[model samples]
Target: MYTNWDDLRLFLAVAREETLSGAGKVLRLDPATVGRRMQRLEAALQATLFAKSPQGYSLTDAGAALLSRAETAERAMRSAIAELPDTTDRLTGQIRIGAPDGSANYLLPQVCAAISDDNPDLDIQIVALPRVFNLSRREADMAIAVSAPTAGRLVVQKITEYHLHLAASEAYLAAHPPIQSASDLKHHRLVGYIPDMIFDRELDYLGDLGITRVPLASNSVSVQINWIRQGGGVGVAHDFSIPAMPGVRRILIDQISLTRAFYLIRHTDDQRNPRLSRFAQALSTGLRAEVARLEGLA
Candidate 1:
């Protein structure tokens, strides 16, 4: 049976995006056009590819089986396109990065900005969520994660080790009892991640400190940091982020220090694509230097 590569390409987009509107945006086509194309593709194959619902399009069993084959074909096409002499040396495509809000807010803005400055045509999107990203679904082209995922066809690169320390606004410390040690944290209002919402054990900052109470808690790292900036409470803060918030000071750095590493994750198949390889190299190098520079100020 002969199948159009364009139809297969559209199938991959709809599968990855899980919505005709989203696929439309990516392909620069209207939703109605995308829907019609999907219908035509399904009809030509004489098989239902997606189960439609208000939530969006979900792949049926046959669609799941076809996804791997479609991805293989996609990678082959990318490799062929990369070999063409007409290809530009500069990266010029949209690449979405999924990351925890802390890095997304404090780290990526500068790192990605420098990259974009060098390659003006490159479009970078950062999806800041406080949970793990599903790369298999193509939610992002790459992701920065606190921990390496053990079970996925992924390429994981350790970016750098970053530090965090107990911190509070200078005003809060002046108004509250002096914190001489970890024990003193019990006497103060603590800000941290919501107990039940802690996505990763690495994010359980307060629990590691053996503190049970969090009077001010949020699922977002930015929210927790903002609360600390406003004198809401003492909480663990990223060392790199401290220089940006003037009044926030790290407390008991000698006694209360936490270290974590960031890992750059990409789909295994994408390792063959030269564009992504160059971008990944630039991102990793920039993140290491940026982390060192910022932590020096902290």
Candidate 2:
């Protein structure tokens, strides 16, 4: 039996947000109400959908099995709504954006919030996956890429350039030997990405530092930042992101720095869609302002 669409919406929100309170905030409903509805839905389906823990709610096997179906339902509902002739001029559809972790975590949230505030009906999903996008497969409606596509039917616009520098916690630097130059990095513990999993060559940061191995490594920028904050080691961080983080400070700024560009990319076929074009313009403007902040120009 099909669960009510309303219940499915709640389930999807909880699944995505990973907490009842989080889902409640998104749905504008009370947590108690959300929990009760989830219980009712579980009873109706005779399935335990979630495994609740102190950390957050995670999908049970049954819930995992149902996720794709739920997503299909969501897409169908959105498609049906999008196809309806709009009586109002507002955009009503979802736009999924794929972006590298640094930009996704540090920059896009405010930009997306401002856009969503203006277009209340729009659903924006930021896939903060630092990997190349397959635009032909519609992996993302839009993306912020490190480099422009050399061969693809994709429209690309250079957004802005930003800088990254070696950084570490104050405590870490005090406890460890002084780093006077790039050569000093070898004497300190370093956090960076796993070599084999470096999806984009531009992300091979350690190579730029002339390091062949990291003392601690993960494929996540957030993890690397946390390690640095915890005095795990020194690592490279974007200038824009480190300012928001009080615990970390840049090191050897004169000796080591990297500059990179962000490109706003979209499928060429989508250029004709008014909603897509409008969002692209907003994103580009917002990114430029953010880059200004990164460059200390804002």
Candidate 3:
């Protein structure tokens, strides 16, 4: 049996991260070193632990069998460390947050970076996507969602109310017709979310634009913003993001601006965990402050 606690720690990191590079980032070691350690662990156990693939590493049956026990060991180690005096301030664990494209691309990098900078021992994974994250399945430790979840054993916190507006690049507007009213949107190249791929109803910005379809569409808000930047078309953009975009300018602010909210979600059980609660509070504070800055309140 492997008796080295350090190697077991590395193994547990790999199991949670599923990639050498990811594990290395958390463990503060080189990816090559992580791989070598994993090899050593596998050799000692005489079993294939991870199935390597282009996507990432997946646990073999042997690895899966050992997972629960390894996790139990990890918990025990944490508990023992916590019992030591003067260790209450130290935090160590993994936290994965899922978010939609808008906040994920533009907002979460800043928020999560600050969190990581403060807590060097914490592993943070930001799963930025357009779909709902299943909290029950443990897909993400927490989520920043466009809407408040009404179902499941999830606790919700209102992060902020953000506004969006119709926006276009200077080059795009120069080549296209003038926008006098909401109805004039039909004459120009409109960019928006793909209807069928629309994951959340709140993301259906085109419906508010009085258009059934757009000339160019994508499921990614970052993609839509990029298309608009390249003069692909006019699209809706978060007001905060528009200020940072060099070429993009807001249009129809009086007639087309809309407000949406972001909610912080976690499983109800997580509310009892101090680490989760503290991190959630930090996230909420950061998001609200950013939103206020975006709204010119800060």
Best by the TM-score measure:
1
lDDT of 3 by residue, 1-61 (tens): 5668788888878887889998888688999999999899899999999999998888999
- For model 2, residues 90-189, the per-residue Cα lDDT tens digits are 6667788999888899899988898889889989999898688876545678899888888887899999888888999999999999999988887889
List where candidate 3 sits over 4 angstroms from the true fold.
1-86
lDDT for 68 in candidate 3 is 66
The digit string of per-residue lDDT tens for model 1 on 1-298 reads: 6358898888988999999999987688998998999889888888899999999999999899888888888778867865556467788978899999999999999999999999999999999999999887677889999999999989999999999999999999999999998888878999999999998888998899788789999999999999999999999999999998999999999998999999999988787778888899999999999999999999
* C-alpha lDDT of residue 30 in model 3: 100
Model 3 residue 7 distance off true place after TM-score fit, in angstroms = 18
How does each model score on TM-score?
0.92, 0.70, 0.72
Name every residue pair that clashes in candidate 1.
Answer: none
Between 1 and 3, whose TM-score is larger? Answer: 1
Per-residue error (Å), model 2, residue 110? 1.2
Position 204, candidate 2: lDDT? 86
Go through the candidates in order and give each one's C-alpha lDDT: 0.91, 0.84, 0.84
lDDT rank, highest first? 1, 2, 3
Candidate ranking under TM-score, highest first, comes to 1, 3, 2
